[model samples]
Target: MTQHTDVVVVGGGQSGLAAGYHLRRQGLDFVILDAEAAQGGSWQHMWDSLHLFSPAEHSSLPGRLMPAQAGETYPDAGHVVDYLTDYEKRYDLPVQHGTRVDAVRRNGERLLVEADSGTWRARAVISATGTWTRPFFPAVPGRGLFTGRHLHTVNYRSPADFADQHVIVVGGGNSGAQIAADLALDGNVNVTWVAQRPPRFLPNDIDGRALFDVATSRRRALDAGHTDTGGVASLGDIVAVPPVRAARDAGHLHAKPMFAQLSADGVRWDDGSQSDAEAIVWCTGFRPALAHLSPLNLRRARGHILTDGTRALGEPRLHLLGYGDWTGPASATLIGVGRPARDAAHEIAGSL
Candidate 1:
């Protein structure tokens, strides 16, 4: 069956929901397609101890503010899931669960969204599928030959699974720091934290809210035709989340240089130092979840779609949201997705 709507939103996470809110205000009929069986989106897959770097007040969607969780300075994954669930119901957004989008391609005057459940033809398509679904693992030497249990951040759950084992956590970003600290704090697991460069920690007082402000400033500067002054990255890479700070202060979360290679049972560093480990966790980041749009042949180098803001340069009828700065500054974060989403909906409404 072919369903018709003014817009078809891919992914029902924060970004998609934000887009839906603006679309509703714009009075556009739209449907959100979500592969996840339920409401939480990628937050459902995060490790048990994961918490937002910002407070509940600062992390919110377009139309609704995330309710504060009592006794928690920073909301955990579960809290976020509950907030999203409530947001969906409160707004009465049209969402189709468990529908995996297969392809998005042009069909003359409109775009065709082919999914496992059904097909939808829409005047515009907004792809808000975030990066969580696509974890990026660097091509490290001897990775294929490693006999240990190697997994990406997406597969990691809790420290219980890796207890009493030597584990190597690779990557320099927040995930790497968090997981490394998580394991180190367990005391049962021997952890080797590896990063390409020295781990940089932001001031303890700074958090996601501060980072968002920095991003906003940088965005305004760029919009005013000024040189790039840098954003959260200029301050540091890791936010001194509570657990990470504790672990660092306890001298349990020190990072080592990137390894030279991996062995069947261990890793070899550039200085010929060797450390045996039973597992390796790749905390490396993720790429945009954009395979569904492959049929359009819009991808350029580095898996990026050329875009002027969120609108694809190749196809103005399609907009990419919440991927990263390319879409909008801090667009990937909850508090940051609203502006681009609003702009995208505004542009779509005007065009239609």
Candidate 2:
């Protein structure tokens, strides 16, 4: 079956929802196609212990303020999913759940968005597919040979399942720190956090709010053709979240250098020493989910699609949103995504 719309959003996550809201404000007819069976994007797949480093207000979307639970300063992964679900319902966003997009190709003047459900011919296509689906795994010797359990942050659920086991948490970012801290609470679990370098820790007073502010300032300076002198912390910098701070105070927060090889039972350190472990948790990171855009020939060699603001550099009809800092400074975070999404919506509306 084939349908038509002014715009077809390829993702139904926070970014896509934000774009949908803006598109509605423009009085544009659009449909949001979600690959998942229900609402909630990457937030639904996050580990049980994950919580926003920022307060509810600083981590909200454009239209509504995310209200926190009583006595809860930071919302957890479940809370985020609930809020996103509510946002979609509140706006009555035209979202087609369980519609897995297959490919997007040029169909004359409009773009043909082929999904599992049907085909959509859109004047413009807004792709909000985030990075959580593509987990990155560093190449380590004997990685394939190791039989012990190995998983990424995407697959991790809770610390209880890792109890009574020695686990190696890999990556120098927030995920590694948080997961390591969470595992420390379980007395039976022994966790060694490994990274290429020491992870930076943010001052307890500052959170995602300050980070977003700094990133915004830097982006503005760059937009004005000026040098960015502001010092904003990267998203990976360990926020002094209660759990991580408690873990640090308890002497459980420690960093180890990256290991050289993965043995069948455990990993061997670069210093020729071996650490026995039952499992390995890779919190490395993710790549953008742009496989469906292959037909457009816009993907760069570095696994990114170049864009002028939100519009694809070579293909203006294709707008990429919420991929990462490359698309827009601070575009990956919930609060940071609004500007880019709105900008893309206006650009699409104006063009049409």
Q: Give the poorly placed runs of model 2, Cα more than 4 Å off.
A: 230-236
The candidate that wins on TM-score is: 1
Q: Which lDDT values do the candidates have, in the order given? A: 0.94, 0.90
Candidate 1 global CA lDDT score: 0.94
* RMSD to true structure for each model, in Å: 0.8, 1.3
Structural similarity to truth (TM-score) of each candidate? 0.99, 0.97
Scored by lDDT, the top model is 1
The clash tally of candidate 2 reads 0
**lDDT at position 306, candidate 2:** 89
lDDT of 2 by residue, 1-352 (tens): 8999999999999999999999999999999999988898889988888999898998999999999866789999889999999999999999999889999999999999999999999999999999988899988899997888999999998888887899999987888899999998767799999989988888888788988888888888888999767546544478889998899889888898888999988999878888889899999999999999999998887689989999999899999999977777789999999999899999988998
lDDT, candidate 1, 1-352, per-residue tens: 9999999999999999999999999999999999999998899889989999999999999879999999999999999999999999999999898999999999999999999998999999999999998899999899887899989999999899997999999998899999999999988999989999998999999998999899989989989999988877889999999999999999987898899999888998899878899999999999999999999999998788999989999999999999998899899999999999999999999999
